[model samples]
Target: MAPAQAQMGTIFLLFIGISKAINDVQMLKPIDLSIEVLILGEVLLSWKPNVNPELESYVVKYNVLIKTPMKEEQYTTQNNSTKRMVALHKGLCAQVCAVYYEREKETARSQWAKAKLQAPPGANGTSITNLSCVIYTEASNNTAMDCSWLPGEEAPEDTQYFLFYRYNIHLEECQNYSRSHDGKRHSSCQFAKTDIQITEDTIVVIYVNGSSKHSTIKPFDQLFNPSTIERINPPMNITVALKQESLCAEWMKPVSVWPSPCFTYEINVSDWVTGSTKQLTVKDNSICLLTNSQSRYSVQVRAAGSDLCGNSKQWSAWSKPVFSDKPQKASVLLLLFLVYGALAGIMLLSAVLCTRFQLHRRLFPQVPAPRNPFKDLLSYNEAPTEGALEVISDIDDPEPNE
Candidate 1:
């Protein structure tokens, strides 16, 4: 009796499974899945539902799958249409299916209907390549943007590229264009503070299209998040001071056109005495180290967007290095230099004066000489009287001879 009961149960399960299979086979799929371009990079996907009032009325929802050249996405909605922002340069493929859910459980699903959009075809390597962009957010909340790209390998000499971007509802063109290679083709573009608006929910769309005399230059488009591509300025007012036992480093966050909730900091401290270096990562703008002694230190601080704007991998450049007690030491050194310089100048002047006086004495020496003009005449007269005496003595001896 037990074996017969088991057989009956197995047959019942088989009947249910067969009935389900037949029901699924007869279920109709969604019809006429279509894509409509709302804007440059935004599109709408819509389809007609398979409506049958004879079937039990359960809420139907759609499952949408999007395939792009770079990535894929899936979404579920109760409506027959959905909107999305995506790059349209390479086109995309979208598929939608209706799912039947009863009592919060999936009861059945229909077949998938697919649609395709074909981008304007061109030569293989005629599209722009290696495009990059950056947004500069200053401390005063001023903003600017810069973008650059390289021409495709098969691009022609006369190929000129134009750039357009959109973040919110307004699409803007590049006005301050920077050209490359003899100014023949535009390779870069710049935007002023008034051109863009950025927020946490903003999505940036960049498009590049080109024209050439020889060939058709294929266009390229890309999507970006403002926070991810932003180049944050380094932390300002960075100062390190010695407070009691710890060397405390403090700074202010970078200013930008939009306010940021918080920031992460990197403080690199180098000990002048120990000849060692340290890397410190912190969430706040201030940090302190207990060096035990009053040893001088060198420090630099750099910052990045944090919290809602957090980007751990993208860090600003390190700030210029600041040293503990550097200002006092510099002033002392300068004062000593001035004092020593003045003393040396004085000594040099005295030495020169003494040397000049000694040189004068050696060039003109004192001598004992007669000052009277008639002294030489007196001497001549005395020398002549001696010759006269000798002549008189000879005359006296001549009398004896007579």
Candidate 2:
């Protein structure tokens, strides 16, 4: 009986040993589990391989962690959650961890990888600010101005920045000129390309960060004209005599002149008839002057200086032209006399009509004749006669003086 019991016990021990050895072999074999992180759109997550010989499937575990300069936050999965975790911001730095499993055994966790991360190139996420241009009086041209943006929290010290420029002549229309660099944390750069000559009503625009600002300047010629005449210094009343021949002309200056004149006088003649223009520079004011022969000549005097600024005063309005040939004096006098006589006749006719009207009003007055006050009241039988009055008197006196 003892031998039989020992044999059964040996068999039981062998069974237990075999079971333990099998479990150890399973644990020694590596589970085929691998993880890969992928970023798609807004969500970032990990994926596992399905064709591993050892693992029928994989159990993936993931968590998101945000690391900013000021603070950090961590989120985990719960309640059978299988979807990929979303990032808080595209510009913020983040990390993702992924774990792989095969059936009941945990295999491996992937190394944390950068997830949904973005770092702008410059301070304040912008390279340039307040980019503008103005007419620089020192440079005798236009120049650009700009300010640097403040540094962002996560940006590196060695980040690079690109500066761009565009000029708009009209609203809603833009033209790109050139681009430059803001090296080593510089905030602004003067645009060296703004050297073009600006005309009247020219609008200039500058752009930065996909936005724009504008300025305008008027033309220089409109603001500064060299042909403007100054006021005369000393007042003078001078008579100008003009004479015109077929193609030549002559003029006489005023008999009176001012002392210590600062400018030299010149005579300019423009003929509309022949389409010719001539100028004769005169050193002294003279009585007689000759010009090129022209049918119609406009004469004026100019005060000029030899300095760089050139002449300052233009001549007064052109003098009336005089024909070279004299007309018949007798005929001109006759025409004038006829005109005077006609005007006198008209005046005399007006006076006669007015006098006749007055006389008519006086001779035939508008007032009616005086009317008799008792005409309507008196009747032939009712009128008191002289005999009635005498009868009354005789009655009143009684038998008087028979």
Candidate 3:
């Protein structure tokens, strides 16, 4: 029984020594591990050697394992030296372990030092394809712009995309995003009114790009003038009329621009007969009067944002021309001449009729020779006498008395 107890005690000591050895190996983990993004999807990993003196002497190199959503990579570095892993994407986690050589035979790994990688500055990739933008002015006169694009060629399903813009000297990323039908992120962005710069010489530029675990593209960039795109709809439904001696033109504002007051118009007037053209600028949509009323005239209108608002310097497309003809003076002169001639002819006819009537009465005189019918009858029965007093009675009853 004593010999059996001695053997068990020795075995217990051996187990305790093995546990100590395992504990020492576990405590050889690297200290002060940290990660930083240096440049171009490359990460710099740094750590310090273990504080244990014996473990530090045995350490030979460090092994790095960078795990990404797409794949994992392994790297080796000299002991106590920082390791740089290239071609890394965002959402990367790093695991590092101290490699120690045991008796010049094999390498042993320490505990892992894990971290998530930082994103590289800006989007990396080739130019995005089929990028388009337009001002989104709703019926309520809201000032906003929408931009969209297709992803880069052969972009993986796990690829991520981002959009940014530059106007003048300022550069910024688009924060107002619109989602796809499934509520997932899409390759579209909205720029509000406040994001726009409306200087007299404003120039806007946009860039789109994508990134994946192993690759990035050269960013695709484009430049634009907001005025050239916004308010691009031509003036609509123009009407022209003759206003007294001048040509009048009226048109409705473009439906593509917002806040009607922000627009200014250019009215172009041309003479069809003379082939001469005149241009006029007005804040309103109508030109009250145009010059050169003697010839037939045509008018066209276009609009742009004023300095008080969008400050768009570029003019939109012109409206379809409208035409008007001025009244002629020859017709009025001919009408007056006809009216005067008619009046003069009527007056002359009245004068001629009055003169003829007077002349006829003067030329033929009327004479009176008898005063009564009985005198006429006595004259007829008696012979021709110069003058006589004659009386006649009723023929049947008073003949004896006469």
Give the top-scoring candidate (lDDT): 1
Positional deviation of residue 296's Cα in model 1 after best superposition, in angstroms: 4.1
Sliding window of 10 residues with minimal summed lDDT for model 2: 215-224
lDDT of candidate 3 at residue 95, scale 0 to 100: 78
What's the residue-level lDDT of 10 in candidate 2?
Answer: 100
Query: Model 1, which residues run further than 4 Å from truth?
Result: 1-25, 194-197, 257-261, 292-296, 307-313, 326-402
Give each model a TM-score: 0.73, 0.19, 0.35
Quantify all predictions' global Cα lDDT against the true fold: 0.80, 0.40, 0.67
> Candidate 3 — which pairs collide?
124-217, 125-217, 125-218, 126-217, 126-218
Deviation from truth (RMSD, Å), model 1:
8.6
Kindly give the stretch of ten consecutive residues in candidate 3 with the minimal lDDT sum: 81-90
Tens digits of per-residue lDDT, candidate 3, 308-333, equal 77545568878888877443453456
lDDT (10s digit) by residue, model 1, range 1-402: 999999999999986885575476556678999999887788999999885553446678888999988889998998888999999888899998888776687767778999998885666688889999988866556768799999899998888899998876878889888888698889899887644555656778998988888998899989887767888788888888877778888888776553445577788998876789999889887898987443568899887766655343378888899888953475578779999999999999877976978854666677878688688567765555553643344343355644
